[model samples]
Target chain A: MNIKELHRQYKKRLAKEKRWIRFYQLLLLIGFFVLWETASSNRWIDPLIFSSPSRIFRLLMDMISDGTIFIHINYTLFETVLGFILGTLIGTILAAILWWFPTLSKILDPYLVVLNSMPKVALGPILIVALGPGMTSIITMGAIISVIISTIVIYTSFRNVDANYLKVLQTFNATKWQMFKEAILPASFPTIISTLKVNVGLSWVGVIVGEFLVSSQGLGYLIIYGFQVFNFNLVLMSLLIIAVFATLMYQLVEMLEKRLIKNE
Target chain B: MGFLIVENVSHTYFSKDAATEALQDISLTVEEGEFISFIGPSGCGKTTLLSIIAGLIRPTAGNVYIENQKVYGNKDLSIGYMLQQDYLFPWKTIEENITLGLRLLKQDVDRGIASKLLKDVGLPAVEKKYPRELSGGMRQRVALARTLAVDPKILLLDEPFSALDYQSKLKLEDLVFKMLKQYNKTAILVTHDIGEAIAMSDRIILFSPRPGRIHEIFEISEDIRRLTPFQARSHAGYSPLFQQIWKELERLEH
Candidate 1:
């Protein structure tokens, strides 16, 4: 066949394959909800614990009509974004400090390993008591959770940047600061963006656990409150909301990645 | 006095396991505008010697002098060092990469200078494009532009064209040779190619491997040195020098 005709057939096959995959994804989602609703209605499963999707949707509608869910979502969203930003910013700054002072990095090597291995969530209670059981403590929890890992990962990327690039800069009589700014930081951008993707999920875990402990506000608080009241529908709805927002945050990081590293 | 001098320079690399002597008692001198090449077998520390001369590393012994001033620990010296690969900053635009040295030096970053250097390297009107957008030969040309942008007094080229295809290598050789002569800049090239060494350099220093020491030096005849690299390869004196250097290199490898 002609080249144009063959190309058209190739594109048509690609479109068909994409449609089938998307159709299957939607089918799986709908099939899961249908199965859950049916099992609950038929008393085949413990509806009180599992909670049907319809029941959760009804609870969502009630929360929306009362205009109470917005506050929780807004509070959670603010804390999450602030935590993610602070975590990445502080982590990157710490990494830069480590890069600048190789001696210091070597000295802190054992300490960093210990801190990274230790559970950051275990420190949540102490943070709540120290900073008070407010948004400040929860935000600190979110920021603190991802900070150590981010520092380690980002610092490794900074170190792994091709030494030849620094050699080129050295020929120019570049200062250490210039070397960091021109080659080291720009070269590590891809790693930093990937870490951002990871931090989105980590910050969510931190904030939610903080809310579970504090039990005052946010989606995590809603889930804890639902559990206390035995309203599994509210818990499921809060979980679904968190899932959606986390994916959205991840997508936003991906967008920033595209904007930042255009050359790749 | 020579414009550049390497006097009794030796370097030994110490690690946890062992110490490797990379260069031993290496010394050389070059005039202001001369082109020199170091051709040798692998692991002969030609790159080590080049890095030493560039003042990026302090030799274990001896010193390098430029215009009678010490090289090591002198931050005022300007040297252009190129590697096998282009090594352009991938995140930066072509213009930004080329003008990087000037920006770092706190000099006036003139767009006209970047465009002019790009034009000189035969890559005009690509200021906004990233390094990844260019082909291999084009990226090397951009690298050359970046190196020459700072207008160093001496250029140390560590196999800058070795990564390119033969055709691109030939073209860049001619361009670089012509540009260096036109600017009257001193240059030191380290290469494994005997013919490249003969065609591009006025003097070829052959090095022996394992504790790299200068074994022999061949001075190209005045006639062949007058031609461009491509033409120099076709010149009558080129083959004899290439053959002689090839035999010497083969002997050194054993």
Candidate 2:
């Protein structure tokens, strides 16, 4: 079978998708702009309290010219990147440890569930107490949230490896390292990449929520400031910006996963 | 004592729930360079016997002797086992999967050895291919090459070709026959296929069910072993051989 044929099918599907993308984007732009103008013209909402699309666009232009938005955006992006790396690293290591020691994995299983189920907002005060706010608090919270997801995914993936593969290795009198290197790791790679994809959205949630708890900068801080000052357009602007960046990260992860799996 | 001896073995899987005996008081001997086939009804401890020899499971009451040395507790790299399913690593190329055993053994796997094996198995072009890229017959051939790559003294096969189509099955049977003949390797093939047992094996061990013990052993003539799988079916003497084997099978079926 020509694998290129299979990939051609994917490309064809993508072609159909882009047409829909263009269609929806055009509709969304027209709809949102028309709604903003109509609401403004009719004085349905206060202009200063909830700025229209034109006003928000002007604010965006000014922010871009002065690089104020860029600076804050970069800082938030840097924190997320750091947290993403740290959380993924720690989570992978912890998962390996848990898998290595089954008794420990068993003992920690219930505690991990509890931690996962706990209200993340309740941890805000504790995070501020420990990290004293700023990038530190945001990064810590992001790591805590994302690391759990990574651990659970990696652990499950490692456990779910093909028994036949293991049997082959065992028959060969393979060392533990060899078994892990050949069978366990390769089998879990796709899963780990998918886990990373899942964590992208989760890390964004972490960073934004942590920022709401405490931060003088970032899109999250801007959202809170807009709400307090009653600037609805700026709130929507921040939300959109965060959404775009998170989506970009998720796409990048997916692209990387495809490449990695294909190369293997 | 034979070249490889299995002396009265047993196993009882004890659980908090209950204990189940898997094998009981089994003893057997196989000579060097012998081609043996194990034929039995399902759940007859046939696989349990193979697993014991492969060192995957320990026989509770018996000892396994290979080359007159006790084989239990020796995790030393010695034997090679081929399972019922091809168990080819999908992620790995055919050549890589074939070389897996040799690489693990820290043996300098000669390219010639791999190439020759591939050629011998009619899969020279398939070296760079992955398991998914190959057909069921082709995959099993690669698996056989992988088992052979170790240059093993004893080959333990568990229903190695039971999954193949009729044409592939017959062809693979021919290939296996050629390999066993060429290398003079002792092979223990576990198959329910009476035709396969008769066509390929020098000796057939008929097994009874549950606490599986040897029912009987039939030794084929050297003249019959010389015949190709297709020709063997047409041999004048083949009918009586089939009749004798069928009689054992019919008895076991009851």
Candidate 3:
């Protein structure tokens, strides 16, 4: 066959392979839900504890109709997003400062390692006392863990930027600020984006944990309330909501990474 | 007066526990619009000398001068240094990478000049492509364009073609030589290849290893000066010059 005909056949095969993969992914998702529903309806497992898909769906609908789910979602999302933004912003600024001031960075390097290793969840009650019980406390709790991680990751990336690129700038008689802008900033951008992805999950966990301690209105509060009232279904529903929202947030970060990489 | 002068320059890399001398009291003068090559073995400190000239590093004992001004550190005295690796910013497109020096200098980036330089390097169609998307040779061409964009009076090339394949190296040598000559810019290239030094340079400065000191400077025969690197390789005197430099390098090897 001619080259064009061969190329066409190759493209067809690739398309067919992609379609099969997508089909299998959808099938797997459906299969998991079907098996869960079947096992619960047949009493193969205790539905009260496991709380199958149908029961959770009904509970989700009930919450939505009462508009409670939206309020909870909005509150949780606000805390998480605020924490993510503040954490990343503070972290990046601090990392840049550390890079600019090497002596200070050296002094604080071991301290930062100690802070990073400390369990942030153990500090929940202290955060509540420091910031008081509210959105501010929840957001602050989330930001604390994320800030330290982002700072360390970004600072390490900054220090490891290619020396050759910096030499290129130096040859042009570039100022220190110019070197940071031209070489250091652009080179460290990928690491920064990856940090954003990591901060999404970290911020979510921090908010949820904070909410469990002091929140009156959020998914975390609902889970704790459900456990107290012995409404296992409600607890399962809250968990499902948190999982979906977290995945969506992570996917959003992934999308942003794709766009940024494409532009680069 | 010479356009560029190196006076008793020496560099010793000092660490916490050791001091390693890379270049001895190397002194040389390069005329305006002349192409010179520092040819030596691996540890000769030829690259160290180029970095010192480019003001990236200060020598231990002496200084370099351009137009009677002493090179203490980075000044606005337009000197371009090209490395063995392209060192093109991978995040940027070819056009952006080429204009980086101009951007950093707060000068206007002239698209016309960038295109012209790319055209001169025979890569007229890759302005929007990222460095990694291009071959090793194309990236180096973009790097050369970047160095030229700032309009440097002197170019320091540190084995710029060493990383390329043989065919790409030959092609790049021709284009680079012709471009330098056409621009009438002074250039100092440090290389291990004797043929490259003979074909591209007006004078070749041979150096000895371990404390890189100048051994001898050979002026190219007049007839070879008019030819491109590709044509110069086939010229009758090319083999003899290559053999002579080879013998000198072998003597230094011992």
- Per-residue lDDT tens digits for candidate 2, residues A77-176, read 9878788878887888888888778899999999989877876656878988987977898998777778887888899888899888888888778877
DockQ of each: 0.91, 0.52, 0.63
Local distance difference test scores for all models: 0.93, 0.83, 0.90
Best by DockQ: 1
Kindly list the per-residue Cα lDDT of model 3 for residues A104-168, writing each as its tens digit.
Answer: 99999999999999988789998889988898899998898799999999999999998998889
lDDT of 1 at A72: 97
Model 1 DockQ vs. reference: 0.91
lDDT string, candidate 2, B1-254, tens digits: 69888888886677999876777787888998888999888878888888888878877788888887777657564787888789888788888998999898888988877678888888867788778878888889989888888887788989888888999989988888888878888889999888888888889888887667788888888888788766676778778988888887788878
TM-score of structure candidate 2:
0.91
Worst 10 residues of 3 chain B by lDDT: B67-76
Candidate 2 vs candidate 3, DockQ winner = 3
What is candidate 2's DockQ? 0.52
**Reproduced native contacts, each prediction:** 1.00, 0.49, 0.74
Q: Output the lDDT of residue B169, model 2.
A: 88
lDDT of 2 at B96: 91
Report fnat, model 1.
Answer: 1.00
